[model samples]
Target chain A: MKLEKIRPSEITPEHVYLSRRRVLRIGALALGTAALSACGLPSPSPEPTQTNPRVPKDLPTDKRDEFGDPANRWEEITNYNNFYEFTMDKQEVARLAQNFKTSPWTVTVGGLVNRPRTYDLDDLRKFGEEERIYRLRCVEGWSMVIPWLGFPLHKLLREVEPLSKARYVRFESLFDPDQMPGQRLSFYPWPYAEGLRLDEAMHDLTLLVTGLYGHPLPPQNGAPVRLAVPWKYGFKSIKSIVRIDLVEEQPATLWNTVAPHEYGFYSNVNPNKPHPRWSQATERRIGEPGRRRTLMFNGYERQVAALYAGMDLMKNY
Target chain B: MRVWLRAHGLQALVHIGALIPLGVMIADYAQDRLTVNPIQELTLRTGKVALVLLVLSLACTPLNTLFGFRGALRVRRALGLYGFLYVVLHLLVFTVLDYVGDLALIVQTVLEKYYIVAGLAAFVLLVPLAVTSTRGWQRRLGQRWRALHRLVYLAVPLAVLHFALLVKSLVGRPEPLLWGALVLGLLALRIPAVRRAVARWRDRVRHTTSEWRVANRKWRMANSK
Candidate 1:
């Protein structure tokens, strides 16, 4: 044969393939679909994460806020991180956490639950999964939008079946002093711990994230698994979790224990409440010029505000 | 070479050395290598440089006081000016880049954050020192100038405290503590009692060495006779 004619469908359009805006629009549409269906409507199959030539688009494009504000550069997202378990230097975390072993990890769910069970990584992955794009705000006055792959926390909680005595859900990170260098030094009360109220843990927006950017969670970003409560400050979403205990009384968290005056138990993203060391009114969004006005509950007020209806946010914060 | 270096060349070297950090920052910015959190990187780097140079400037007094080095006294003004420059750059990064020209937010931040308050106080304390560093102003103020410059003693510890407070926590950080110790040690050396004690020790050592030389000479002479 002299020559073969190229088929039109074989070649993807350059604009559709290369434009991040289009991908973000698609992500927003996906999120919109999820939100709509969540109200007793039939859930639609989520769009498969788009593979960009440069950046991976694995997380849902949140339909709310400015969806197309250029998902922070992938390098910025991965390189500039804050995982204190490895080291305090933001640049050094990725390098230090790279060698951390996370396989064969098990998380024990105990305390005031009807079914107390220790789950392997595989067991956690078996729960229903989705791509959720949410904004993460740090108490340090910086923010980032992340695409996380995980399931609703409620799914796992349902399986465990919390008893009537379960008022708060406690999460603890791996505390091996030999492995986690930060644990060796008592800068913080060792064995980083955090908690959420029963309702907050069971909220639809709460996620038990397992992966990010279509890859297994980076060691620095929290290895085997972690929690992602987008409505609260980043630290509230504990990383490299090893235990989940439901308690009748509010649990003592690491930050609260270290500096109770600064970090409250709730630690909800409230722009009105200023951190003792810094202002929370505005936050620098990574890869974006200047600071943006931080939103209430980090812009998830519509979905989460009702949860804290009468509670004084300032006092809780 | 020593003589030439002691004259004006050493001060020139100090000037060149002091500017290198700023040059590196500019080059990093131009080359697009300021890292992911460039604003933060710049802020922290400049703040560190300012604190280091401030401590170094303070060190000049102790160097001169203990060693009687005239050159140390000469470079004191230059180090202080450079430290002030870096402090300005640090504040510029925080206000312009971090706060982004929001005057209301800036005031709110300064009011609410104690670290910001401490840093601002340190910078304000340095302003008069930098302005009066000129030879003309120094001559005009005369004895008052020395009194005014003593404010650096207060400024340095506050700056270190500001640095300590701004970090995640001070439990593990030894850098700020080391700076604080150096400042305190230098200040302690300024006391008249400590200075007199050091001088007495030096005179005793000198006297003992001369006496030993004389005794050895007498013993040799007696043996020759």
Candidate 2:
């Protein structure tokens, strides 16, 4: 089934379209206006506050407004996680992951890089922060809009300095069977792995997330650090990342290795593509009323489309 | 105590124990604590409970046959009814909560997913068994009741396979495989040849052990005297 291309205007408010630039601009204007008003003139203009600058934008899809609150609650976001390292049960994973220690963590960034270096959790925190609310669509046909706080992944990639030979970026999760009980079972060959093409990894939307909803990331939701590839399936955003390897070849990911027919290396969220076990035409947003038609690349097509331009999405998927 | 439980409280105990999971699920729904996808959660939990209870009910016949537990036979009907109740709830949750009464979507889903077909088959097979569970029907059907009730044996394996298929992979999950093994074991024990073989082995072990003990005691007494 063909899905009509979703216009940016349909999903985003006009002001929200340039929110990063406009909000900062408005903040500066508001500050300048406040300064002007303090100096005092008889005639005063209306404050920017009245313009509803801080009011949250309605989420993508017309249904979001109809449903009122589109974003999944913080509790639901934190608790309902699919960290198979802990357990498969959505509710049990949070409690199980809580037992694992995320502090004193270090990620080794090596392989085909010009300047291979290890970054501790504290080192990662020093790269600065940005709060981005992105829609996460799981291959299993459920989605959540999460406000994640992290810097762009390219910042770290630049610091590491990828060589010309490095064509793919492989991510590896923490592999401790004692802490991650699911590792005890040979589920996905322990230390869950995910990879992306160099261009895809360098996308601005790809984030090395540290927190969500203005709070530190919960253990179940990949605490301390994880990748957020908004344009792809949730599994593409590997959790509890411990290693980043810039490789010449596309690294074998856990899901792709487990089920090559169902999960692909590029598991981009494509509504046209149906998973072997289930349909991907629509997804039920957590804490929402009903399913919405899934958009190509999970509605990040405008930003990430050029990366996959001239490539066959169906075959790659 | 065994006789009292057999004649009186066994059915009550089974009924109460089986209802606890359903009560917990209902309480979770009422409290708005039924996970993120409550519909899916409710559907899965109800389906699992039904499968587990169906297996438990099937085990009752083997329990009576192999272990001579008359109490197990007494509560078998209640167990089967509870299983049927959960199956009905499972169907309701899938239709009303998950699909929102979209019969077309349900039909599409059934066609697309083999697990759904397996589950439906199990549910359909149980309907006849449940209808004939009454004492009046049992008498009316006479010997045919036993033949009809044998459908449950087929239904249970299909239910387990449905669960296995629903997960998409049984490699990581042991619950489905364990349930399948249990049903297979129970069914194997029902075969007259297997049952006689087990009984003969058990009898031989018991006789030899007692004989050995008697000889040893006599030898000890003679030596002491």
Candidate 3:
């Protein structure tokens, strides 16, 4: 019973055999992961191009005011959006809103306004662009510093010339369900409405944003035109405006209409007044590792506090 | 190989399936695929997996009662512990990552948020069950172990409620409700009357099949002779 001597070539090297096993394990795991991920987990979206081709390489920026926080990366700001018009999933919004039509867009400014004019995207842009870096704090306890490009809403409001009867300014988003799938959901009072007091709407800090990071606003970030009320929660800054109505009474906003108790009409970024579901004391700044203390009026108290001077924010909230 | 698979396959499947999500999560983290808000992503993923495993664990008895799938019983403990593991991970992500180990914030959240309270309750309830899952404790505890494990009935619903209440919009989000429905159905199946009815139906089907098999065998034997 003589055992046959094995050739060097016949036997697999220890490292080779081990590596083969490792590869097999990895392959199996990867296959399983892919299958499971396909079940629901969001896949990374494709790299996006500059949303608007006509946007300039350089724009006149406001260099005076300093918040000291770095603006979130373009990808972070664009990819993570709460454009429920497209989808509830923040990451999916960018992908879903890729083909959204913002051209030939007209925003009608009417109710209780003297001019009662419908301004096209071109007409709105004539107000001229200024790069204003502002902190956008979401009601969901997330914050982002974004360099927004557009003029103040007050400029547009002044041109429209609000009547004395006009107390609240209501903004409505584009409501085409064919394009905005989330609008199809019957629960949300659709056309995604948001409102601001006349004073708040006319404030210098209240920007009617058209672009961000030197590029025309991406659809997910509210393309063509949107509002950026830095002092209020991000939702207060309505996206993709289709209508602006100045009425005597407060307008019905989407979130407020949905859950008035949870989402107040005056959803100011107040750390003291906690949301019914989550704490407002701290917010995780997007692209940052840890949570930071949420600021009173989102760190714009000095600028906007005078407007809400006598009013009770806690009661309003 | 088939016989070996038949005896051990379901357990192997449960173990592998249970760990796959954690592996995928780790892979996602390494690859930077956890969306822009990784903490929220991690929290959601871990919470969801925990809820699913816990629900699956709760399904074991109902599965056995309805279908006589004893393999479900064998993996029940493993399913539950995996669920507990995920719950722990979920809490860790929320506290360590999201809250940055800020105990004050965690306390505030747990106190302020009803959903967080519900989730915390579910996790606290599961702790004892996971601790006494071993055969040694099971034997010592005896019938009490079964009683103790019945906390799952409460824990599962609480977990479901936690998920349901946490969602921004309940109308658009049907997952928590679907999971609730599943848990409800599983709970309903555990009713003694329902269990007896299902067991009776199963027995009747088995009895009829065996009778047919016997008759066929007899006919074949007679013809051969």
- List each candidate's DockQ score: 0.59, 0.30, 0.52
lDDT of 3 by residue, B72-139 (tens): 99999999999999999999998889888888878887888899999999999999999999999999
TM for chain B in all models? Answer: 0.88, 0.89, 0.89
Question: On a 0 to 100 scale, what is the lDDT of residue A37 in model 2?
Answer: 33
lDDT of 1: 0.80
Ranking by lDDT: 3, 1, 2
TM-score of model 2 (CA atoms): 0.79
Q: Which candidate has the top score in DockQ?
A: 1
Clashing pairs in 1: none
How accurate locally is residue B216 in candidate 3, as Cα lDDT from 0 to 100?
99
DockQ of 1: 0.59
Clashing residue pairs in candidate 3, if any? none
**Steric overlap count per candidate:** 0, 0, 0
Q: After aligning candidate 2 to the native by TM-score, how far in Å is the CA of B165 from where it should be?
A: 1.5
**TM-score leader:** 3
lDDT of 1 by residue, A12-117 (tens): 2223332332454365455664532222101112332422222333333333335555455446666777777888888888768755777768999999999999
Fnat for model 1 comes to 0.91
lDDT scores in order: 0.80, 0.80, 0.83
